[model samples]
Target: MNSSMDLLQNYIQSFGYDWLSNVLLITTGSFFLWVIWRLIYGRLEALADRTQLAWDDLVIKAVKAPISMLIWVWPATVSVGLVLATHSNDDVVWLGKIDLILVISTFIWISLRLISNVEAHVLDQKKRDETTVQAIAKVARLFFVTIGILTIMQALGLSLSGLLTFGGVGGLIVGLAAKDLLSNFFGGMMIYFDRPFKVGDWIRSPDRSIEGTVERIGWRMTIIRTFDKRPLYVPNSVFSNIVVENPSRMLNRRIYEKIGLRYDDGDKIDAIVDEVKAMLEQHKDIDATQTLMVNFDAFGPSSLNFFVYTFTKTVNWARYHEVKQDVLLKIMAIIKKHGADIAYPTQTLKVDPIAMARDAEQPVGIVER
Candidate 1:
């Protein structure tokens, strides 16, 4: 072994240049490292694919990039270290610092990769809505990134206490400057955790014009696709401050309308009310589980008013509309068939003949001309 080392050293020195040695060493190390990486990665990938646990795939993918990078990095690091061994001054200290920084950077990269994979895996397993899952994953990544950066800074010989002292004051100034932005950011966080509504849910603000299916929930704002196919961007803080109605959560859609029939049809009002109730009860699309009211509710000047109050079995907007139309048509048919007319507003006034004659007998109170 000693003789072989002597032969290689002699061959390298035979080149008459010191840098040639380093170049050769790095080239040979990098070549062999790449070969080893290929073999290891291939084996691991096959094993991952064969396993039933899907997390293994994510784990394998997460490491593949870092490990590939490490292959090149390790060889380069070793070669640099060998070269630096020839120097014994401040250069050594500088090289050591660079090496430490590289190590810290590599760790941060690997940690971030793993965090991303774990976040994705957990969200997929939970089957969370797309927008909410994205928000959650971003928050998770941001948190890990913050911690990782701090760790790297500490590894670079930064004093954590000093940084904290400085950052506290700077952070306060930044917070005040970005007050509304921070409110929106926290509002997004609250929405992610509270889950008032999610992607694909139809939501509306009672006080605002924002009404639509949720398309995206980001850190600052949420994108809602409106009924007319317009996209509405609403600030996250708005949601925190307002009352939102999620009609998608409703079990049934309501139908409430008043029908008026002529006063001449008053005799048929009872029969009409009974028949309407029977019709509602027999309708398949009407929700029997909810309230149903069909009664003569009021007397108008020209008509007897009856209200049809019921809930459809479906929550679909178009389906509810169709059901309502069918119900109204049936009611009209019942009214016509029963010799009762649905009335429109009309006014009539008649003065008595005796009152007119008495008024004529008495002198009209009018201005003399």
Candidate 2:
């Protein structure tokens, strides 16, 4: 027993014993973490397969379970064991500082990954709904990066208040330099809250007179896909200030036009109006509740002008055009059936035949003919 004790004491005194113990601890911790990772990943995969929710699958795909698990668990386990292995007081202090850094970094990494997972899962639900999720994802990423930076600085023994003061001064300068940018950023927030238009909505602005589908509402700008298949990036500030018309939100739209008839055809004006009102009532695309008016608006020099107004039940541009074309064709046929003609600008020239005859009769007198 004395010999065994002596041998144990000798081993403890040697540097090799301490190194070996640390190695064993590290290996054990690593193996334990690996096992935990495999178990958790396996369970997550199984749950994803069995669940009816597609978002779960998205979460798994986004987080990449194995990588996420390692990011969280590896540092924690290693730091714990390293803290336990320290002997001297100075060594313990150094190990504590190292552990602090490891813990903060690990937490930051995990937080960032979790945010990514949430974004990916939400976006995978639908294409149009992804716009809001994408914007939120950008904001979340920025927030996490800021947190990570602050945590790192704190770990390095820097005063947070001093850093905050510097950041405040810097922010003031940046704010002044980017006033328009700040305006756009706030505009984006207002747009989100106000919800004047959503992604995939077709909108028109009176000032710019641009018509397009909303593609994305971003921090500083809103992207639109124009009718001509071009992308338009309008500043959020401008979007907020403009008078926007969201045609797609309407249930129906009004169509009005004017046609001219010759003054000689005035007798048929009432009949024509009756025919038009009847035609509009019979059409499937025309709204019945709307006031369909056909009136003699004014009289022109060569023609009589009449106004026609009706409501289309469809708000779609293509469908509106189709309905309008059909109505026009029907109107033309009705006019022809009634033996009435459309008129254009015309004028009459008057000539004095008696004066011309007198001039012709006296023209040869000077020659004694």
Candidate 3:
């Protein structure tokens, strides 16, 4: 290596243009680095694809660009230092700091890329909770980035103690200025820890006009896709105060209905109720272990009312509706089988006998042309 360096130095002196020689050497070195990286990265990528472990693929992908940057950085820094040496050693010192910052940035980039790749891989697996994985990835990126910035600050000869003091005071001022933003951020943290709902969960707030599927949860806001297909951007802080019901987590969907029969068929109520209860208990979709009720509930003004309250085994919205329809149809069939019909509102008029007799006598032959 020393002989090679001497030969190159001799060649530069022979040209009597060391600056140009240095630039050419740096350019050539960068080109060779790129070529070397391409060859090595291609093989690694092929190997990663062949391996059963998915982590290797993520690692290879994450390091591809950062590795290339790092390989070029060292040589460039060395060349810059050599050039700076001819001018002044004091100028050469900045090269080390710059080199350190570049190195830190490269690693930070690698860390962030790896986090993203891991998040995607886990989501593709479909076994892990996507919200939790995304939250973890965000946290990991934040941690690595903060650490990288602190390291770079230290390398730049900043005073950690004084900087921390200033940061504390500045943080208080910033917090007060961006209180809502901070609240939303903390609210997001609360969601991550408490976990009342997650991505793809159907949630609704009683106190707010929020009813939708949660698409994403970010630091300041959450994205909800409403049933009408509109995107709702809700501040995370709102979740702190509102009551959110996550129907997605329900174990069973309720089927509640009031079936009214004509008052003339009141006597058949007992048999109809018995048959409905038996049908519910035998129905495969109905969760009989849950609260199931089929009985005479009330006497309406026009009919005898019976309520069928039960739960279905599925929590899926579409599937629950299907089960509910089947149960209702079966109930109607049972009612029809018992010769009872569904009731509608009807009104009967009763007139006094004297008034009816007087009206019948006056309307016989009066005619106005």
Which digits, one per residue and each the tens of the lDDT, describe model 1 over residues 1-369?
Answer: 224333444454456767547668667877888888889989999999998998788877877777777667645655554455445332434444555556666666776787788777866687756666677678667887788778778866799999999999999999999999999999998888888998789999889998999998888998999999999999899988899999989999999999999999999999988998999999999997799999899998888999999999999999999999999999998998899999999999988999889888997688988
How many clashes (backbone N, Cα, C below 3 Å) per candidate? 0, 0, 0
- lDDT for model 3 comes to 0.88
By TM-score, the best candidate is 3
Instruction: Give the range where candidate 1 is weakest over 10 consecutive residues by summed lDDT.
Output: 1-10
Q: By lDDT, highest first, what's the ranking?
A: 3, 1, 2
Which scores higher on lDDT, 1 or 2? 1
Stretches of candidate 2 exceeding 4 Å from the true structure: 1-40, 65-145, 209-211, 362-369
Q: Tell me the spans in candidate 1 whose CA falls farther than 4 Å from its real position.
A: 1-17, 77-92, 114-126, 129-132, 345-369
The order of the candidates by TM-score, greatest first, is 3, 1, 2
TM-score for each of the candidates: 0.79, 0.74, 0.90
Off by over 4 Å in 3: 1-17, 73-90, 362-369
